[model samples]
Target chain A: MTKKAICFTAGKLAELGKENIPDELLSGKGLVYSSPATLAYNSPGAEGYGVKRAGLAVPESVMLIVAPGCCGRNTSLISNMPGYKNRFFYLEMNENDLVTGKHLARIPEAVTEIVEFLKDKTPRVVMICITCVDALLGTDMERVTRKAEEALRQKGFDKTRVRPCYMYALTREGRRPPMVHVRQTLYSLLEPMQKDPRTVNIIGNFAPLAEGELQRYLTRAGVTHIRQIGTSESYEDFLKMASANFNIVTDPEVRAAAEDMNANLNIPYIELTRVHGIDRIAKQYSAFAAATGIEIDDTEEREEAWEAVDALKERYPDLTFNIGESSNCDPFELATSLVRYGFKVDEIYATLSPERFVYIKNLARLSPDTKVYCNMEPTMIYYDMSGSKADITIGKDAGYYCPDIPNIAWNTDIKPFGYQGVRDLMNSIASKLEEGRA
Target chain B: MRGLRKVLTPFAPDQSGAVSVLYSLGGLIVVIDAGGCTGNICGFDEPRWQGAKSAIFSAGLRDMDAILGRDELLVKKTIDAASRIDCKFIALVGTPVPATIATDYKALKRMMEKKTDLPILTIPANGMRLYDEGEAMAYRQLAEVLGEEGNENKEESETVIGQTPLTYGMDYKDVSLEQMKLLGNSKIIAASASGVSFAESMGLRYEAKAEPAMKYLTEDLKGKVLVCHDEVFGKTLRDNGVDLDIATFFTLHDSIAREGDRKISEEDDFTKMVLEGGYDTVVADEILRELIPDFKGKFIDAPCFAISGRH
Candidate 1:
């Protein structure tokens, strides 16, 4: 008899709806906020996720950061920010609560307490930020949030609505990971308002923005109507987001949110990631202009960046460099740009993040013999000249380990944005090298 | 516990009027394991075979001709190593790779020791069936060297077994080194040093076994007559048939340092009275209540949770 093999046929996967945007924000009636886990997983960055979760709010808006205590302490840095100092609140969990799933019950109580605390000013919305613990316990935060909202309604708080936002670092594979999901929650507040045909909502965390540089760039690119989430715009501005021709997603993690918006609002999105090299960044802008069919003049601001990079390279042509972090944007782009400007990228220590892997593959094609190392590999110790040979190192926390060697902490916390970012990176490198020479 | 059981099996004492003790023993004691074998299969007693100290030359593989897989080098090295050492016996061990390769360590050991005029022992590096199997192997090997006639010469000596402590401290915490020093300073009778290759290295034989001024000590002391050997330091409560006073104090005072709500005087009182009262009361009460005149308590009961809060 012939052997028969059992196999399953592929079926069409169901599509999830775009994040619900509330009309209050679009109508200038309230505010919308969003937060994200940091670029790396675990450690202080995990705690930073709570800060980002709590800080994404309008003036007088209340937000709750629900996370384990180990991951809760990182909020101190976010609390130091002048704009979000008092708007955030934290709920810390103990090891016992983590295992027993006791913290799940605390969510509704936390929301009620914050809502009551914010009673003086009827908060347009109260967002409850649930971290990865909910993912582990399989806690249905939406159901808990509904119960919280109903309880609030019974207490006569009609205007204040509660929303559930997840910060699940473990769920990075889905079409809507927590990063994009948090953005959806923020934009959901603006869904009730009619779309303003001319206005567009920038769907990404504003913490990475260089002051007002994002709005200036969009304005410079001939888009008169532009609004960034967590900026001056209210929650009402979000409903008008559908009327815009497109959304510009500055971060790669928000690509899924952009796609969800693309499917629902019919607003096309342009992905223009942040960069630290002027010519390459300016080239990226030109590419964005080409894609959007919008024209952008090469203002004097662009020329100054080019001049700074040129002067820095001319002065220090023999500079040896090491790239050690995997930023959201392409690290290989930074590596190649520095190498293009006559610097030897001696060593690179980064992870094989799927998004960042493309840059690494391209770098491999360009410099096949260039020594590359993974973060977990034991060989990283040798990169310090005292151990191995590296003139300059870049990226997160690499500076801490290689303090004796000249280091440029180019990653983590430092929001490398716009044309000025390119100049700043070059200047920072030059300053460190000059100090090393002395 | 097999190692411990093997320890208890009444060996024909080499010397009389001496007692020996060992801790949680009785089981297979296999070594030369990789990270995969943990918990019980492998133990700490590996040979110090690093660099040149490895028993290569004395094991007599000196001829350089056997490196080509003649299998003769194994026998030569085994004999040569045993002969060079002061010991009159050998216990050759195979590494994990050698065990997997199924190299004939047994045949090689037999061939080598016969030529060298000394006894050789082989220890299985794989599955640990029980502790007794290993101790039995060790005892049998020791008997072959010392023999019944040789044991008759002993006047007085005790053989202690197992030197590992209840808690192992490896430099990562405070007081670890101090604790190790305290253990080292104790009146140690005998110990099987980790990484001893030749059989004699397990322990040295006293030339005058019938010597009156000799005392044999076991490396570990678990279930033995609770006696205080030194009175200056403390009483040998072993002779008095008493163990640690469990009720006197659950823990020492240092555990409360830096605690936020610690009441020093009250805690100190609780630590003392409880430990003394509990241990003495429990042992005495059990002995008094027993219906059988010769009732024996084989197992030592310890309260594991007692020190949880104090630490």
Candidate 2:
């Protein structure tokens, strides 16, 4: 009569098919558990580069969170971090404001006041972050931000731009979730500029991608100026992102913004998904080389990545892993890659989407009995990690569940991509496992 | 400019307060929001969440769910979660979404009651109000729903109410459900402003004092001081010979309020008080020092997790 967390084996999931995936495995189907894995998804501002941090990705930009007091409550954690001081402001909506819809009117004045408060360090952009209350109200944020810009103009601060950053949790499952919309909002600041064929912008993560094979490949291909929002030193430098001839989209969340850039700024883009499988990484590079008409000799990088994988395999022949979604790599894809590397993946904590069923299908063929637990399932409250056979855990959430195990939280802001990611991740696992033995 | 806060982040809201009070109460606590509210509660506001596990959850309300007023769906979800978890009761904590939609908690409670055998307690705490109000509401609901009558003949035991980590930080003392149920027989010590409000509302005789703030009584002699925290903390200091005036961001009950004591709402109010009030020492969370950078005064760091999320 003891309680247990709900989970399904990879074989059972593949047998049932994506269409019949259990409601417990899929997101937005039940009461979401407040697990550490779901914290970034649930409260975007609490950890990582969620809507709050993502909205402020533009250099010299500040955010004005317009929501009920609750929505902005956890932002104090973000505000306390370095480089975030005096950046976050709030306009708390009371019950009267909710009913009267008068809080929207005050937003313009609030923006003006915030701009005035930071006189010497005036922001180039003020991102007005709105929440579920405004989402339910159907408030036209575009119009509100326009009014705020006009108010600033009248105050002789015409240079400061006002933009809307939707932190709407209600529209999370929609086509443009908060993360996607924030990217579009950030990229929308890019005005038409003279295109530089040599300059390619990395459009995805707010933090700069790790200096690895991708950057080296681009550098060797005669691309002199590679612009990423995180590397941009100033607001003026960030504006130069518009000058890129094309963009390299690293994250799927940034595709909408890349599409916007294509339509408006005339900057074409090529997407490179972060995967762990060494063959897939090489295949993606080959596709990149063909598309860009630049010869990519990835043989050395591929061999190095394989060497790292083999080294780890030799060290821990039957090493097991428990991967969570809060990490840089896709939990399913990472699990599949780990299984293919001749290692056992004990469990994967991630949401099951139909698009990711390919990984699950691959995992089913390799590791049929590997359990998949949706981090957001209500039954996760009873998650007893005593049953986990993982020798080591990866991602912050997996570490939280398995405190006794050696963990490598690969969820850093600086992303790891391509073959470098594969090699680095394998080496990190081996190092952590070795350290555990020591 | 009325609601604009350029100096400070928003303090703990009512939803966080409700969760703090009901967190260790062995109840299946559900915050009625899309997800962010529950995230704020678990991820930031509730310090107990770090090393412990609580049955706190989000209703996982979608835009369509709110727009369409899917009350039945919420009821079904609650019942489903209750069936899976081991809990003594179910508490529905409200946030901005329900407030915006004008959710009738009484009816939701009725619907949930019909579906499950466990007792249901709904706190209609819109995210608009501060944590003190939410804590008071939870205390009121807990007393009304669980307080047993005909306990006047039983031996009296004293229980501290409203000393949650949000207000008292690591020094928070939790009140159990067993203690809550026997409130009618217990002599209550209102440990905070919320507790005072709760005790006052229930027409119960109680002593309002914060035992944690008693440490400040032995501090070095000071000129006129401004104490900004829970009303009970200020009252406790003042009662113990501290020459201080209360300037609380939270509720300052008339009973605890002196002639000079004020209930401040915004950052400017605190700034105006510190700069213009001519006090020698300012006792508050040091995060508020950003507001009165020009004021040359002795500042005491009384970390209130509600104001500044420091432990």
Candidate 3:
């Protein structure tokens, strides 16, 4: 028997501890943070949620942004919000700081200052944000925060709490990126809250949750209290999310966070990733309703989606499908899905994720010789561009490389969430194919 | 098998590293192309181009001839050109292009002394590879190569780096002068365009961009006692105090070394501003400690890491 072993050190994993934190209350509650990569690389122009979803599921108002003058310059979209304006602060460092590492002491001080600023109108939580510098300097932000918290508590400040939040671009693993990490952090916070009857927390906002379809599905299904993180009307409104009796993880990245909530708070979760076809999406919704004991009538939405797909099929019977992007969504699975709808997936440019690898293995069991190309490798070489039958491609940045084929930009930096994702995808594809036919 | 096919097919074409004419900072436009130039380590396989009539007359030059500085035909032509160029003075650009041993240089200098009276200067022309250090090293080497000049009344002017083909920009030059004036009390030759070449060669010293190249160099010359105690101007400015030093051109290198400032070049400035700024925000604190063993102070731009690569 081969013995399995774990290689990670406890010291490394336990580096973020209670004592090292600035505010125990903030950690006790929950917080999330995110940072953009300065120089980023995406496979063949694939969209990335590494930075945007770094702190996806945190109760919004509790988060604080910490970065250098140059690094945090682009986060104005977040900071300019009426809710998040006070949460952002900058610490300007120059060339001398890089070599000498003198900036380590300021971590706790900045945390304490931000907490104090929020003292008068303090929420039940505060999340201290730290970016990539902490990684390089190896500054024990948790310890520094703890020391600062102790100092602050002694100074007669009470009822104010802060916690350490990290937004690292280096650790993103395909679909399991920082946005997933943020959701896990937030779910862990909502775990302790008393569960409400018949309510469910939506765990799909690790990236932006498409509102139109997801909202309509929840409403039609009679599912109440649907909470989206990025589309939150108010940051403080995130506190009311604990009332949900259950949760649905529409994106895989939210699994860790959902699991944390389930393990701690007894809020069981069901993973229902984005499905892009009407029948497949309806079946997934029916299965989810059966598991959760909820009645969901997706009949109207399904009919609309089917009509749209049929219209697209009528116009482009010879349209060859090419999905070009690096993603966990298996091209073989997509091909099978399209086959059910009477469409041929001629060629695909994609990379398999660890999560999707099992699907491909199963796909090999069904179709012995399916042609799949890695996103980085050019498909034009193997399948001659002149003779190739591909008329439409679905992915980001594929049009630039393949001008012969018309492309639809359905790829995004957000995790496509839920059965609604399937509907949205169908709508998107239909529109593109129709437009191309015209 | 698929990966092997991808690699071995040879028909698969990639344009990722295709060479293009890129115009960047500095006055010179460098055209860099791959798949060429391999005569670096071993001796050249092909002889020098012999198409010219003058080259045909002196085709039999040898290593021994170079070492002894006795290639009469080559020396005669060089001397004739030096005397003939319509200029008040002539400067020699000594680069790795035609590398000779130190002994060869001495022999060549001796031969040139015996043969011609024109002012022949030699300066290194190492292209930009190791950042600003190349410029600084070349400038210093050029000064030493020039040896002692009888006319010591050279005008006090700062030679900016970005002025000619060997160029960067005025910002580095300004920063160089700022540091020069701050550390060395003398007026800068050209405060805006203090090229490293003139400062290093002409016995005039200039400050580097916020990197510690000059400071390290100055400190290394402690035997001469030509440096003053090191203090950070940024620190002094923060505390509202003046920490001053007066260094002459002869003692500039020593001053830099004594100051112990690592951010004496533009590369340091760019790194600190862009790369380090990103690192300080994203990575965990313990990880940072492990990576940067020599850390002391607090985080400089924690908030800067939030946005990234903009400010």
Best by lDDT: 2
How high is each candidate's TM-score?
0.52, 0.99, 0.51
lDDT of each: 0.41, 0.90, 0.39
Question: What is candidate 3's lDDT per residue for A1-438, written digit by digit as tens?
Answer: 111111111122123332332121121111000000001222000124334324423433444444332233334444444544455544443334545555555655654555565657554445555544444456576676577567567765554455566554323333444455556655544426666664666766544465655566666667667765654454456655666777777667677877777677777888776656566677788888798776777677667767766776787665566665433344546665665577665555444344444444443444323445442221111223453356776664344335578776665646554444555666777677667679
Q: What DockQ, between 0 and 1, does each candidate earn?
A: 0.02, 0.79, 0.02
Sort by lDDT, top down from the best: 2, 1, 3
List ranges where model 3 is wrong by over 4 Å: A1-48, A56-87, A92-102, A114-126, A129-140, A148-160, A173-177, A206-208, A211-222, A326-332, A353-371, A376-389, A412-420, A433-438, B1-311
DockQ of 3: 0.02
For all predictions in the order shown, the interface RMSD in Å is 28.3, 1.3, 28.5
Tens digits of per-residue lDDT, candidate 1, A1-438, equal 111111110010001111221221111111100001112331112323322543364334566656542233334344555765445565655445545666666666666666665557556676766654455456777887788788778778776667777755434434666656766666555443345555656666544355445566667666667766555455454345656767888777667667777776677788876776667677887897798776766566688777888888788767777666534335557776676666676555544343444454545545544554444221221224354356777765345345567777664443657776777777887898889889
Candidate with top DockQ is 2
Chain B TM, cand. 1: 0.32
Question: For every candidate, what share of the true interface contacts is present?
Answer: 0.00, 0.82, 0.00
Per-residue lDDT tens digits of candidate 3, residues B6-114? Answer: 0000110000000000012111111010000111100011111111001001111223333344435444544543332222222332211122222243444466568
Report lDDT (Cα) of residue A203, candidate 2. Answer: 86
For residues A117-145, write the lDDT of model 2, one tens digit per residue: 89899899999999998888889999999
